[model samples]
Target: MDWDDMRVFLALARVASLGRAGQVLKMDPATVGRRVSRLEGHLGRRLFHRSHQGYALTEDGLRLLPHVEAAQAHLSAAETPNDTGAGLSGQIRLGAPDGCANYLLPQVIARICADHPALEVQIVALPRLFNLSRREADMAISVSAPQAGRLHVQKITDYHLHFAAAASYLDRHPPIRQIADLRGHSLIGYIPDMIFDKELDYLANLDLHAARMTSNSVPVQLNLLRQGTGLGVVHDFALPHAQDLRRVLVPVFSLTRAFHLVRHADDLRNARLRRFAEALIVGLRDQVARLEQAVAQADDQANSENP
Candidate 1:
């Protein structure tokens, strides 16, 4: 019945390892084990199926999770009376695709850190799904909108990508005035089968056979492009950093995808999380003009050619 015991229970359930939970809670492993045992005793039921592999939540534990999370959210809301989020301070783990993590987030996070000196932001730049239900990340910027889950989703921005090649590479290769010219060029792209998210299947709609050189990491692909390895789809936002890269095929070969901001529904009431979400939304909105400029460059090129 103690909130402190429930906190221990939540921590253990999240990590599935007493040592890890203790690390998170800043308690000794033995103390964490004792607290879990006490909570189990008070409830008159085994919450975790203990094994060498680690703790697995029982059905009762799973059932209790939602209620506990709700209580935690309400408690957090109660403690932070200033809903404006100016006084918010806590760690926020954000999972984002490599491109956003590397190029987009640094400035946004830097500003957030300056605004709230007490807040810490951790960026996980993996190209895969972030499991919000399991608390893998407090929030995520995803390539695709989640179809179904206990999640809150918002469209962060619509960003564009175009087939690009290093100016040096283009100088050596046959001129590419059209999409068909790409066939004669060495293409750099994602390894088809290794793409975890359907949204990342950039080559699928291109009708291209396969890449001459491929990498799963977007940054790696960009590096390959920078090295003049071949033509590859590059994000518009990334162009600011890679000035040597030239947009090829003009307006004819381009892709636009939406970035979504997602978080667990239960954490919606937590002031710190809410504040970060607001900051993200505002920051991304402010970059809309710059984000769209890459696509506009292609249009300019096309118009010049036609004229």
Candidate 2:
């Protein structure tokens, strides 16, 4: 019944191990165990099933999760926003793909930290999977369109990707006269089947013979491009700032991807997520112009080569 008890429950549920959960909450394992046991006693239902590996949510726990999370979100929002009192002070968990974490987050994180000094932002970076339903992250940045969910979704922008390589790498490869020519040269790409969606998987299947290396990690892929490993597909958002690489437009076929921002249905009403979503949307809108310019430049470069 106590709010702190519910907080402990949520943390424990997420971390899946009493020891790990206690570490997160700065509590001893025994204290965490006692609090969870107390919570279960109050509810008259077992919340977790313990095993050698870790704890798994029981049917009762699954039923209570949404309500518990909603209560916590609302409680956080109940704080007065006025500057005369203590401001919002809690952690916000964000989920992003490895690529976004590496390329897009640092500036936004710096800005968010500067504006809300009391707010703590924790990023859960994964190669491709982040479970918004389990509250792995309150907000997610995704490459594909948002799937079926009650969550509020926003399409940040449609981003174009380009085949790029180190300038030196291009100098040695056969001239990219057309898309067909890509079949003959070695290229680098994302690790095969690393992305989840069917469309992305199909795109990865494209035989860019020039691919000599591939990886699921975007930073690693980018580093390979910089090292002149081979031609690779990269987003312009991550490309414009690259000083060492040149964008190579594959004539006849160009790949564009959309970026979306997603939040859970319950968290949309929370104070922290609402404000953070607004700032992120604003930042994305501001970046749209720059994104379009990059696309146009890539097209222009491609046209010049063909003409």
Candidate 3:
């Protein structure tokens, strides 16, 4: 009913234990239990299921979590005074697919952190859609803008991808002059069923299969391609990281995909998130352009030398 009661609820929901929640809130275990019971009684709906294991959120608790978290965000923003000569003095987390996380996020984060010395950032790189409602991260970088959710979506930038393979693999295997020539060879790529976004199904879009070597991580697939084992589609920004992997069938197989900045709609009023999102959007567009230029220059050099 109040911020104090919601605070107790949130602490217990996170740790799922009375003693642990007490430790977090600096309250006695008995008091914590009492607060939870009192809150539940006020609502006339159970928020948690208590057992020997721990306190698990009931259906109602899950539904209540986002609202409480939103309130907490507002309070957190208010507590940290802005214009204190300390730029962005709080931690913000970002969830992103592994490809961009590995290849692009480091430099961009470096710039943002350099500008905001008091800021802290946690990067959660996984091969899945982050649950913004649950506060999985303050924001997420998605390959495709989600059609469903109470969120703000921004198209950060467009990046490129192309079919590539290690030099040794190409030398040993038959040449792929055309898409039809990709027979009897499997491309290294994300696990088909594990691809979190349709934009990442590069091979599937090409009517090609990737069963020989696969992983949920883009870095792992990139490494597999670097090993001269098989061919695969790779991001242009990532090509610079592994020199041995060379682009092939570039004229025949290339793709352009966009990265989207996604955040909860409730946080739009929060100044900290708004500032960070702007910096992120600007930095990503610049980085993608800079990296794609490098890829193009490298391709030009390769052609001039060979021809």
Candidate 4:
């Protein structure tokens, strides 16, 4: 099968729509469709079932995907490395969730800009998921665990989150001495699935049926919290660097979500990509201690207020 065809198929599989796949590839939707059809014809089997929601993989497509992915990885690794500057000098496309960008990336971005002035870096804020295989982005910062794939991936940090409320709201509402007490209060939340499973997964431990408001934008949700709409589960990194909010007395279980730095296996060999990745890793490590300190201070203040 044509390697380009396989790539298109993989993009379609990941995106679940010809339009979205085309957007990532910078190709016309018809061209993406033609390429997928050609691949199916070459294989002499129906690979996808077209549906209103999007294409669903047929049994044949599911069976062929693993082999296709392996072949692509093997072929990609065989290329001779190019002479990229021992340092970096080209644009590195980075994608990140807004919450992560707001809380975690400012220092990293500043250092990268200072160190590699020639490198034109572009950061795309992706509140929704981005497709890496389609080259939609060169690197991604996400809270989710990396999936099984041919990716150069590493966990940069484990971020913690806990439920918190405005001091005024806590005073007006009934006391929350236990997780069960949260049921009576209005709740604010991130767009349910966009939040990494681990971060909110234990909400199952809480008895609330649903959030009063759900937003992908942390700033918007935080604003609502300031209005005393409800308590919210917010990342330690994203919480305000002030004492306006207080942690309720519920058992604060630490929810650890992995912050992953990922690049396509092929992109990993590009010297610029490698250098930026290293810089990001180093820059983030340096600030992690400071962030933990800030969180500890917040906890201390919160304890004082609640008691």
Superposed Cα deviation of residue 80, candidate 3 (Å)? 8.7
The reply for model 2, stretches above 4 Å from the true place, is 17-29, 49-56, 76-88, 202-212, 250-253, 287-307
Clashing pairs in 3: none
* Lowest lDDT block of 10, candidate 2: 80-89
Candidate 3, run of 10 with poorest lDDT: 80-89
Tens digit per residue, CA lDDT, model 2, 79-139: 6343233344566778887766766676677677787788777877787756776666778
Rank the candidate models, highest lDDT first.
Answer: 3, 1, 2, 4
Off by over 4 Å in 1: 13-24, 44-60, 81-84, 291-307
Model 1 lDDT on a 0 to 1 scale:
0.83
Query: What local distance difference test score does each model get?
Result: 0.83, 0.74, 0.86, 0.73
Q: Across residues 89-135, which tens digit of lDDT does each residue of candidate 3 receive? A: 56678999989999999999999999999888888898899887655
**Model 2, CA-based lDDT:** 0.74
Model 3 Cα displacement at 166 (Å)?
A: 1.1
Candidate 3 displacement at residue 294 in angstroms: 0.9
Instruction: Tell me how far the alpha carbon of residue 219 in candidate 2 is from the true structure, in angstroms, after superposition.
Output: 1.3
The TM-score, computed over Cα atoms with residue i paired to residue i, of candidate 3 is 0.83
